[model samples]
Target: MTLGNRKKNAVKAATAAKVDALLVTHLPDVRYVSGFTGSNAALVLTGNRAVLFTDGRYTAQAKAEAAGTRVVIEKKPAVTAACEWIERAGIQRCGFDAAHTTVAALEAMRKAVTSKVRRSLFHPVGALVAALREVKDADEISRMRVAAALGCSLFDQMLSIIEPGMTEIAVAAELEHQARLAGAEGMSFDTIVASGERSALPHGHATTAKLPRQGFVTLDFGVILDGYCSDMTRTVHMGNALPGEHEAYDAVLEAQEAAVAVVAPGVTAGDVDEAARSVLRRAKLDRFFTHSTGHGVGLEIHEGPRLAAKQTQPLAEGMVITIEPGIYIPGRFGLRIEDMVLVTATGGEVLTPSPKAWIQL
Candidate 1:
């Protein structure tokens, strides 16, 4: 692939692994490693050269779409093309992505290549690619910031328009419509519009249930931009605020803020989760605040370095994660506040700058 620096990065990683070349077969890794978004393609990544092999179904489109990787149109099975390429290139000790290939495929590769050359399987070539993607450059971070801001604007757009008569599905649809109009490619996941008793469900998706005028209505949504992603959540009252709802909402906001405040390079993900959970425990609401504080997000909404009590990974500079805290009182109501954040040199930078105070919709 002739990508700006990705080809070079993949080549460098191959060299570091002491392999003559890397054969990428995973679809996502194929896209990430060589910018080949096609359904069928194998990327052969060498130090100074690369090749993209695909079936005849996409001969012309592969050539046009995958300009980064040199296209090789093959009418039959793809493994044959890979072996033939390896033999012609006189490559020795080539590496394949073990994560993507099956045992049968590995055997076929072994049988195809000459015994004089060695064949090895690497658990993940995508790992190297993912590690590279973890660091959000200024350009990437700015896109994410825009995504979050657009998501907030969409919330604003949908707020006044929504009334107690609408179903949760109706509210979610309008939120998505507003987000798309505000320049988001689409939501990273299904829009969550849980209200009243339904709010007790942690991942409660929008059902046909109509919203109640007083308890909690949790709105969780995210936007995508240029292959990057942003996530955010805000819970509000349907009409007038309830007495205890404000307290729970404030506690969730405080817990989320506490988690976000302590995020920095060298901090453990589990510690960040505890920072939020501790606040809920002090309020005797720890049992209600379930799920991880957050998770690393980028090309994929949920990536590595999970921010949960069960994880031990440390936060690193350039890593972007979310800080979300919630309290769910079963069959009653629930509230949550979430934001995307970047781990920086000093501490954390909250990319989603929207106000977290409970909205009276």
Candidate 2:
């Protein structure tokens, strides 16, 4: 969707919420509405007006990117300027995203407005823009597809260089360096390179620990391409697998694929999560399966529509989410299989078209 249409939709939402205006301080929301990708920005959206406030540094950029929106360059903080503008515009109430705003920031914004309108004017609102962003448009899905494809290519390259003696940190560095060379703006998050016993750590960051001669190495990573993010996890054996390791990997793979297969429009997030958890439960490894099945991935690494127990949110078409299932047994071995799936009307389409079968190096 176009930036103007996005702003229109946001304004409609604000009107429905009984808000005269919306003070968009979150950078992503600012970008979504005004198409301004600057570091500092504040956008105020009213029924018929969309004004973007930024510092002097981004005057030209704001004008160039944020078409159909009034751009104002202020010497003070953009958000403070936006609040002052909202008060001056005689808006009765302006809603702000409570999820991203802190107490200190809210206080600052309130101080920017006059005492009469400070308390009542700055209303706190939930994830209004974020909810709209959860459903990806065709353009967003196209960008995310490229990002996921890049992640798959990085994994393929890493498979060739991975060895028994390489330190986990070194392996992570190699992947990141190659990612930059391959045109990634940055890694979505810290590149995970857990080896052997470390594989059991759900978020085990890359460390100096060397890869074991004959154990599992779980690599969980994502890359930022364009403005979207891609995430996936793959675990590979170094030399020979232990007796239970093969069975454990199979269980996780089946669970992950099962969850991915169940991703379709109108499916409840909890049901998709159950599809994965059920596989592990049948194998009696549910206790080892930690963390939720997956979460929405897009402009942000972790977004809404959380796929976990009791999540009643239904999956919508054009939503992209990850289906990652793992069995992490402490001190023995841990393995995860992840895929980025796009929810479709019929069934889900796997964006990460990489090999998930057992890979032993």
Model 2 gets an lDDT of 0.92
> Each prediction's Cα RMSD?
3.2, 0.8
lDDT of 1 by residue, 1-361 (tens): 2354777887788778777888877676676666666778778888777898889888778777776677888886677687778777877657776756888877777777666653443223445565566766677677788887788787777777777878999999988887777778778999999999899888999999999877788889888877677888888787787667778887888898899989989889999999999999998899998788888787778877788995888888888998888988886888888888988899999877877876887
TM-score of 1: 0.86
Predict model 1's lDDT versus the native. 0.80
User: Runs in model 2 with CA error above 4 Å?
Assistant: none
By lDDT, who's the top model here? 2
Model 2 agreement with the true structure over 1-361: per-residue lDDT tens digits: 9987999999998888889999998898888888899999999999999999999999899999999999999999999999999988999989889999999999999999889987799788788999889999999999999999999999999999999889999999999999999999999999999999999998999999999999999999999998899999989999888898988898888999889888888999999999999999999999999899999998899998899998999999999999998888888878888889999889899999899999999
